[model samples]
Each structure stands twice: as structure tokens, then as C-alpha cells.
Target: MTPDLFGRHRAVLPDWLALYYEDPLEITHGEGRHVWDAAGNKYLDFFGGILTTMTAHALPEVAKAVGEQAGRILHSSTLYLNRPMVELAERVACLSGIPDARVFFTTSGTEANDTALLLATAYRRSNTILAMRNSYHGRSFSAVGVTGNRGWSPTSLSPLQTLYVHGGVRTRGPYAHLDDREFTDACVDDLKDLLGHTRAPAALIAEPVQGVGGFTSPPDGLYAAFREVLHERDILWIADEVQTGWGRTGEHFWGWQAHGQNGPPDIVTFAKGIGNGMSVGGVVARAEIMNCLDANSISTFGGTQVTMAAGLANLAYLLEHDLQGNARRVGGLLLERLRAVAARVPHVREVRGRGLMIGVELTRPGSDEAAPEAASAVLEEARAGGLLIGKGGGHDTSALRIAPPMSLTVAEAEEGAAILERALRSV
Candidate 1:
């Protein structure tokens, strides 16, 4: 049954739309942290649909809000007053740390980032933009133009003159051997050198943690040190928090707070968890930057009533239940357990992440070269053992990504870790 459906999918869908596994299983339904395939196999969901399911699967609050809102009105233009949209916006603005922050909703992260580019370029009146190497923002033309990852970026022709900056990854770069302080200083010097050689860029955009680059991150406070240089030149700072926002990291609500010594970014783009399963994405900027556009603009389906209701409910549940605190405690235990497991496996290169967003990098045994085949083997083994995980990285997709829902519990973590241990051993 699954194979027949897979054949149909391949026939209808674009080849570029990637699918996992030798035989992709159909996920029929889910509850809590578990899901069942059409063949009656139950698997522990660790990836959470690329971390889109921030809360538990089939969460009652989100389902109830979505159903209730649909019963009333689903489609309403942004021209009218939207109570749910306003409420959700107010909550996000208050939590954003940007003074007088304003929110504009979009259907996806790509559009949110596209809106940010429009604002920063118009405000600074410059077409030059700076983005971190080994980073991915989105798939749209403007967003792809700034993406520096060669695997994901297909074209170099762009409307904005883009300059790739260094220091997104601390473990595999020219400055990898440096200590934390030295690494930060080296990245800052590199930024200064790059700035001197190029025109004044409108803004410097970066992911607090490079999501598609296998959850890689720079040394702490690296962005803060660079912020000083951009500030002096009047260039804006935009934090792409699509994967790092809403307390997914153990220590902070937003990933930029990891470099809080520099204060808030001029603009922030967020998606992928705000609405749980619903599509909710947006940009938050100070009124000056958000309102810099002289002409009118409205998203046709950006902030419809249904999605706003889902966002409001999900955000409220996340805060009221203190899922951030849950992520910190559970994530710590899971990380320690995975580290112990990796120590026994010679092919496991490194285990790195702040909270639930963990990555286990694989390499050929006794060599530094990436072992993408080992990653694929582990993924297949984990699936056979009733576990679902993900894989991605800059080096031929050699990193195993494990990001469960923020509401993951101690028992579930232990269960997933045990399955992962066996999978690694099999690999």
C-alpha cells in the first residue's frame, strides 16, 4: 500500500521535493509525541514535522481553537479589524523585546523574511546585504539570494548585491582552532575587513542557530561583537528566528538573547512553531522600520481568522504551561544521554545543541571526512525500531537532527534515547 502511494507521489510531486527513507511511510494520525503509519506501525516522533509541531501532537487546545474558529468564519481580508490577529500580535510584540514593535503576518517564513528585506533596503536606501556563510533563510527569490549554503542555493543572480560573511559555524572553519574569545575576535575582524571592501550594506541577517546547516552555531556573543561594527555604520541587524524562537533554546525565549549584551535586533522574522500545526509566520520590527513602506500592502491569507485563533491558543498554552521550562529540563537529560551513547560509537563525530534541537554529526571512523552513509543507515535503523528522526548538514547531509516537541517528557526522552542507542549500534 505504501509503495503504491509512493509511486503516485513521485508521479505527481516535483522531484526536488525531498522525501525520507527507502520506502516513505504514510503518517495517518498522531497523538502526543507518537504517530502511527498507515501500516499500523507506531513510531516515536522526534522531528515533529521539521519542528513545526511545537506542542504535543493532536493538542486539544489547538484543535479546539481551530475547529471553533472554522465553525464561525475562516476567510477575512486584512483590511478589516481582526481581533484574534491583534491579540496574537500584541502578545508577540510584548515578548519580542523590541520597543514599540509591530507585527505583520505572512503564510510562511520565506515571506516574512522577504518583508524584512523590503523594509531594511527601503529604510537604509541600499541594495547591498550581508548574510552568514552556511546559512539558509528561505526558498523565495529574495530569501534564496541571501542564502550562502551552496547545497540549498541554486542561483547567484539576485536583486540585492549579497556579500557572504564568516563565523556561523565555530567547529569547522578557518578559525575553528581558536578559543572562544579569540574566535569571536577573529570573526569580528573578518566582518570589519569585509565591510571595508564592500559598499554600505542595508542590513546583516543571520540565523541565531543555522538550522539547515545541521543546527550549527557560532561562539556565544559573536553576533554582539559584530553588532558594534554594524551599529557604527548604521547597518540594520535582522535575526532569522524561524527555528530558534519561542523558547526552543533552553536558556532564552528568542535565540538572539544568546547575544543579549547587544540588545534587540532591528528586525526579527519568525515561523515554524508559532501556530503549532497551523501556518503562522511574521516579522517584528520597530514601528520606524515596519512602517517605512510608503505604499499599501496586505497578505491575502496571511492572518486569516482561523490561523490567528490557532496562534493565540498555541501561544497562550506555551506560556501558561511554561513549556520553555520543560524543554530545558528534558533537553538537558536527553543531551547527556545522547552524549553517553555517542562516546561508545566511533563513527559519531559530535553531539551539539542547546535544548531539544540536537544534532549528532557522523564521520568516517578514524577520519575527519563526513560519513553521510552512516547517517542514512542510522535513520533507517531508527525507523525500523519504531522511531522517527531527521538528517541534514552542510557536509553531504551527515548530521542526525533530533527535535521533539517542547512538551517532551522524561519517560518519552528515555524511550527515544534507548531506540537511538540501538540504532547507532546497528549502524
Candidate 2:
């Protein structure tokens, strides 16, 4: 159906089927960082499908790979090994620096996390799973159980052993004064105490940089501290790189690398950009941890032929063009521009992020209000001005997330920033 027709029908659709809180624009086509709606309005897409399309939309190389693979073979069950699947797995392992790693692919990030949780629990024969507060892993039962966000739960909690820790540096300017280092140390000590009291946790799951948690980067030494603590208790560290992996963070191919070389996680989960928007997710476990899983644990459609082809082509394009370098350069430029804009807007409390993943926090002038309404107003204004961004955090917390594709050019980033400036001004 046409975009207009779909919109009209959507207006009358049941609330359950149409549960979108924010109004969505009808996008007709997208290329690189821009999308055109049915009414011929074009938008600078900073969201990039919530960071899923790292290579950008309608990439010719990825499209070609998908087409070529489709003509030859599409589905090859787990019982059989396919060339594309083997190549994709090898490429992921090589890039992740986890030699001898085994990959079990899934169609989405949620499934990837689900699989990782199960694998960690079963391998260690431990019941406790430790995760960070404000972290978003996925929506599956086990994933939700470990996720600290209670908003995601609709029914009784799952019976998984879980502990939630707090992450994020506290700055005096944005809110009340607090020592970030002290807060981090306290959290670590709490974790150590918890570990001492309960059976050792099966795994410690965390987003290298908290994606859904205000895009907050942990305290400088928090990762290393957590690694040391978890190791002391014999717990595996699971880095959920779903939104931060595949060069999105620039300097490192994976966000975990940002934690320092000594903090390499035991297992890393990836999804968003691996297939360049195709439905593919998986975990790269260290050889020892991976060895614990046998043929009994497998997914029939995990690494399908078509998905693997797309993933392999995406990775090849990323490496061949040095997309990570572009992400760093462009991300730095974007952050500088955003900070400049924030300086002019009193409501903009902070501008923070690493690489292409950014967040602009808004607050009421001289008041404690998080100014979530101001953020919503800015979002709507930006949408009207042909720019697409996203909102996160409970209470709407006044944070707008920006995660454009790696293929986005400097010119495009500038245009998006300009559009955002106008939107902020209107608000």
C-alpha cells in the first residue's frame, strides 16, 4: 500500500497493534544518511534504525552480496555447513581478536543475548547473572530477567539469579555534585560483597558503553575493576556490544577495546551492524568458554546462507574502506558541533558520547526538571524540519540519541546538526 494509505489505516488501527508513543514519519526511501518520505520531504537520519544500519541504507555492495547468495543457496540448516556461514564466522572471530572462538548466530540482538545468557549459565553451572542498571539487553524471558530496567517487565519476574549494578560518571554541572570515582568504587565493592555472599555469578553482562542507559560511558577504571572482581569470583564477563560493536565506537573495532587492552571480555555479543541492517546476531566467546558448548546446543536458522553472505560482505566493505576511521573522524566532528550548539541552548545540559553514538541531555534552566518535554518538543520540531533522532531513558530523561551510519559523510553530519540546531531553537 502507499504511504498515505498506510498512515490512514494506522490511525484507525487498534492501540495494541499501533503502540508507537512517538509519531512516526512515513519514509519511502533511504540512501546513506538521508531518507525521503512519501510527501517528497527528505530527512537527515541520525537514528539509522537505532544504530542498526552502520553501513547505511541500500548499500550496493551489501545488496549485491544478498542477491548473489540468493540465486545460489538461501537456507542451509545447522546440520550442514555453508561457505558463507564459515567465512562470516571466521571473519568475526578474526576481527574480534578471539581466536578459536565459536559463533552461534541469531536473527536479532535479543536472540543473541538470550543465547549468550543460556550458554553462560549452563557452562558455569551457576545460577546468578549480574548486569548493570539502565542497561538494555533484550526482551526475551532470560534477557528481561537480567535487564535492570523494570519497565520492560509486564508480568512476574523470571526466577534467574541476578544482580544489578550502577554505571555512569557523575558530573557536578549537570546535576547535584557527586564523586564519580567514589560512586564507581562503591558499586564495585557492593559487587564484591554480593559475590562473597552468593554463589559465584554465572556471568557479568554489561554494555561496554551503556547504549540505552543515557549513552553513558562508565567511569574510567570501572571496566578493569569489574574484570578483576569478576575474575576473583570465577565469573565470566559478557560484553553486550549489540549497539557499540562493528566500529561504531571508532578507535576500536569493538567498544570493549575502549576499556583498555587488559580488559578483553570473556565473551562478546554483537548484532546491530554486523549484517548492515540484515537480521543477524551472534556471540564470540573465548576458546575455553566456547569449548563448553557441544553439538547439543545449536540453532537451525542462526547462520542462514543469505544472512551470512550479507554479513561477510558488510564486514569486507567496512575493512576495505577503513570505515572505523571514518566513524572516529565524523563522530569527533559531530561531537564538537553538538557541544557548540549545546553551549548556546540553556536547556541542553550535556553533550556526550563516543564515536557515532551520541546523546544530548536537556534540562530546565535553573531548575531540577529533566526537561523531558523540551526533548520531545525538539524531537518533533526536528522531524518537521526533516531530521530523524531518537529518545531514551525512563521519565524520558531529556536525552536525544544520534547514531548515523558509518557511511555518513561530513557534509551529511553538518546538515543533520544544522537541522537539529533549528529544532532546538524552535523548542
Candidate number achieving the greatest TM-score relative to the actual structure: 1
For model 1, residues 1-427, the per-residue Cα lDDT tens digits are: 2778998999999998988898887999999999999989999999999889999899999999999999999978898899999999999999999999999999989889999999999999998999999899999999999998888888888899999888998898799999999999999999999999988999999999988888899988988988999999999999999999999987889999998788899999999999898888999999999999999888889988999999999999999999888888999999999999999999998999988889999999888799999999999999999999998888488999999999999999999999999999987
Cα lDDT of all candidates, in order? 0.92, 0.81
Query: How many clashes does the backbone of model 2 have?
Result: 0
Candidate 2: residue 204 lDDT (0-100):
91
lDDT of 2 at 398: 71
Judged by lDDT, which candidate is best?
A: 1
Root-mean-square deviation of Cα positions for candidate 1 versus the true structure, in angstroms: 0.9
Lowest summed-lDDT stretch of 10 residues in model 2?
168-177
